[model samples]
Target: MAFFCQTDSYATELLTEVVSCSPAQLKTENGGKKETLSGYNVILKDTVLFPEGGGQPDDRGLIGEVPVHRVTRQGPEAVHFVSSLLDPGSEVLVKVDWNRRFDHMQQHSGQHLITAIADSLYGYKTTSWELGRQRSFIELDTPTMTTEQAEAIEQLVNQKIRQRVPVIVRVITTDDPEFNQVRSRGLPDDHAGPVRIIDIEGVDANMCCGTHVANLSDLQVIKILGTEKGKKNKTNLIFLAGERVLKYAARSYSVEKSLTALLKNGPEEHIEAVEKLQKSVKTLQKNNLTLLRDLAVLTAQSFKNSPDRSKIFSLHRKEGDNEFMNIIANEIGTEDTIVFLTVGDEKTSGLFLLAGPPEIIDQVGPRAAKILDGKGAGKKGRFQGKANKMSQRGEVESLLQGVLNGTAPKEE
Candidate 1:
């Protein structure tokens, strides 16, 4: 069995013959405008565009102008899968996006440093990971950690970054006891081939298929962006690596600057400014209630002064909320009088009616309902109903006057 290092693994071998490509090549993809590439399965070449059984994304570029859609390892063979048809023995140029490759390297390397720090300092291990397009996250075995503990790990990662320790990738056979002795996020039992171990001297070691930086310094930074509660005893952590950290910082600063202008406050006063605004809103709500109460009293007095007084009377008004109707009815309600009020906007209406003895609410209540296009049942003289529209107020007032004077029939 042979063991390959990280540096040598990237180089492609000369292909004397072509074996296969995926159906994707024929369709044209990977930013290519072409139609397809030949060979479906076995690109029997020592050089490979396929990213093997690693969890990392496949390498994408061109295999002689044909897009290499994907790369997967089958058993012991390396396959060069392409997206467009290609002729056998065709001599073609291969291009790989080194920038993308290096970005993956930085992220993978950062994961190792952080994982090692967590395991060494707190006995927590990374259980799983999701490498997304815009962001990436790792799940840890423990559900939660104190901010102090996480900060310590973060500090350790920075220390390692500054130290610039070398990162080594080597393959060891299952038969090797040294491989079993390593404490890592262990590999799957089904992975029977040579076990690839990533070792950072005096820092951390793990089994991984993803690419990584040659040294810790290449990572630049490993920032844990945030954490969220995961399964029973795990927590998920979001992180940024290398150039992403720089990008995140730039974007965050821009947001802060814009917020400062909108809020009319400096960073130190932002929180205070927001809190003050909330307090002002509450004060305005309280003051509004006081004003409504005063207005309702004045309106009720005007109704009492009118010569068209009836045994049952109601006033329809529009105001902020249902509170206004209740206030008006209660202010005019006396032992022998019933005053009903309905208040609302075009959207909806609310009713409040009060009765006092000589309180013939029962006799007049139903009449009020009929006039308002609403229904309510009560004895004596008190009744209330929601009118369909504001225009119904006049009809409602006229019906109450007729019922009180005995000039109109009450039952219907």
Candidate 2:
């Protein structure tokens, strides 16, 4: 039989210690070996500096004026990574950038409030959290929720922010009876110490390892940017909080002003102006279609007296507006005729080729596709491809003749 003794698992430290130490810079030589510095991991001893876990990024700061380049978790310990290598066994004073830590705490706490609101409002549980460079998103267990529900949850989160309830952190043994009432994803099986539970008064209680603000008011505002659906019944709820909210608001205001200027209307009237423009575009499209029909008729008349004895007609339509080419192709046909039309619009060009009769189509269709560098196959020997480049009408006509004479093979 063996007996094991228990001891305090958490470390305690004072902020004054971090401030008293002088900052140092390291010079590396000979491929990352022989390091000499008096730097030690700060929160490693006190369990304060955030460790990488739970989809949340670790806290960033300087220790004794040496900026922490990274924070990684090894087994159950958080290894603070500094740019300069440190002596393995040396004990050095450490410091954390209190502002950065506090800001992150506010953001993380705000996320809890918003996610909890989502769960309360729509039975959505946060299955994951991603802290990104400029923003963060909480992934919900349920992928879908009505827009009304999302708006309502956003409103409720803001209301809670206004209420400003106290945030309490309690350390408890895994065997605590009250732990059962706190709905959470449960602790990691590998966690060896006591669990730290963060409770937002009567709002929410969950197991978390990240730092947090003491009061909800410290979070300022939490703005839900939008929601996006993900795989496997999950959705990402994007949001920003505290100082980020102000930055977002300012940027949005600037964008709105720019849009108003471009649209020639105030922000309130922007939607109406856009609708008007859309209606105008729709009307113009109808008129353009009518014009294309008339132009196709004129194009057909020109070909009626074509001088070419081979029945190969090459015509170019205005850049873009493929409707005319399609209309022309469908209207005219000969026993062994191939029609080539090129249309160009400002940005893109189109090509249309129509061949008639099985023998004629087989000879000309593949040749047209080859010459145009496009692809199409049809039972009636019709083919179409966007012109690979503009000004290929002559080449297309020449290829049609070559294929008809059995001199050209089908393009690969």
The number of the candidate with the highest lDDT is 2
Colliding residue pairs in candidate 2: 318-344, 319-344, 319-345, 320-343, 320-344, 320-345
Q: Model 1 over residues 1-412: C-alpha lDDT tens digits?
A: 1212143544443234454433433344565565565555536444434364344666665666566656655554555665456666656566566666666667777777887888899998888777666677778899697778878888889888999898888778879887777765566455566777788988776767666777889889888877888887798877888988998899989988997999988988988988998899999989988998889888777777879866665555565455676566666775556566766763355554535453456665655566556666544434445555555666656655665577765464
Task: Quote model 1's TM-score.
Answer: 0.60
Model 1 residue runs over 4 Å out of place are 1-17, 22-44, 47-54, 77-82, 184-192, 274-412
Candidate 2 residue-wise lDDT, 259-322, digit = tens = 8889988999988988999999999988888877888877777776667545666677664355
Assess each prediction's global lDDT (C-alpha) against the native: 0.67, 0.67
Give the Cα error of residue 173 in candidate 2, in Å.
3.4
Best by TM-score: 2
Please give the lDDT score for candidate 2: 0.67
Model 2 off-target regions past 4 Å? Answer: 1-107, 118-156, 159-164, 188-193, 224-239, 307-310, 344-357, 360-374, 386-394, 409-412
Roughly what TM-score does model 2 have, to 2 decimal places?
Answer: 0.66
Stretch of 10 with least lDDT, candidate 1: 1-10
Q: Judge candidate 2 at residue 220 and give its lDDT.
A: 86
